[model samples]
Target: MREPRIGIFGGTFNPVHIGHVRAAIEVAEALGLAGVEFAPAARPPHKSGDPLLDFALRLDLCRAAVSGIPGFSVNPLENERPGPSYTCDLLADLARTRPGEQFCFIMGMGDLLCLAAWKNGLGLGRLAHLAVHARQGQELEAFGRFLDHNAKAMGAAPTADPAVWSLPQGRLMQYVPVARLDVSASDIRRRWQEGKRIDGLMRPSVLDKLLTHADALPAGWGRPPAA
Candidate 1:
């Protein structure tokens, strides 16, 4: 039997935005994934000093964002797990619970560029294939070179195609092009703080929840008075 393919999309998701939902939808359709799991991180190891909203609220927002979306679900694995969240650890947990399943770790081009700096970065390929979303202004040639370097390091044969690269332990990495959206969670927050319109940037449910509790936002989230 063919192993079920599941896409693991992990992020802070301080507030799930339309950009996020759109990317996941596009990637899942492009890869023919069985399902896409939006895993919200309780505490990201790489980010610091930025006050994240409560984890429960973030999880609720994630659930709301994916509501009524077919083949999409939210996973609170990272939120329930102790300590800072790491991709490798999440993959390990999934491997244990969902044996004989294939996982594709979905990420953006920027994260791919910095993968080597991640915890147990080299082992990432062994855990799951990488489904990287292409970003604007990024050189494909440079990306190919980086993948070739990593493949060689893993004792895998290099390929002429940059879109797909084979890795040791039968892992594969593929670049997936998705619709570009100028939306981001931080931008949404900033807009809300400035009392500017953010109607279409986020899902209606999430935007409504945030607006309903604007006063409860974390410290430093409000806009400063005009000079």
Candidate 2:
């Protein structure tokens, strides 16, 4: 039997933006993934302060953001679970549901650096192959060092470590070229508060919900500051 070509894109998605969606699509296409699942962390252990939106609302926005996108869907794995969510735990759950499936864990360069600090970091290599998106101006050599430093203790396959996982011919991180976007979730939330139009930034469904719950969002939601 053929292995399932699955991609996992996880994030806080304070307010899902076009950039986030674009990144997922670009990676999925490049990897020839059969499907991509966007998992909004229920309560990110790494986030210092409280989430801007309630767990239910965050999940709703995530679902709306990828509603029409083909092969893209939101999973409630993290949100449904109690307590702070960990990537390792989430991957374990996925492995149980889809036995023998080959999974690809999609994340950014920054995430790879923090992998060693995550729970069950060593076991992750057994769950999925790592596919990290390169950050702008970030050298692959530096990333490779990070992997080597962390994996040496855990015994994770050095070759599978995204930091060192480069194509022989290219001598580059197996990267999927994508258009970089400057849009940030914080910026998006800020714009909504400043009464700026968010036509192209967020999905209509997500925008509607944000507008519906304007009062619950951060300080300036849907209202401009006094000039």
| Best by the lDDT measure | 1
Over the full model, what C-alpha lDDT does candidate 1 score relative to the true structure? 0.81
Residue pairs whose backbone atoms clash in candidate 2: none
Task: Give the lowest summed-lDDT range of ten residues in model 1.
Answer: 218-227
lDDT of 1 by residue, 36-114 (tens): 9999988888876686787778888898899999989999899777998999999999999888889999988778778
Model 2, 1-227: lDDT tens digits are 56656888888888888888888888888778888888988788888474467777888888888898999998888866777888888998888987877677788766767777788764566667666776444557766676566554544434554444533222223444466777788888777668677777877888888778766775423446655
Best by TM-score: 1
Each model's TM-score?
0.90, 0.81
Per-candidate RMSD vs. true structure? 2.3, 4.4
Q: Could you tell me the lDDT of residue 74 within candidate 2? A: 87
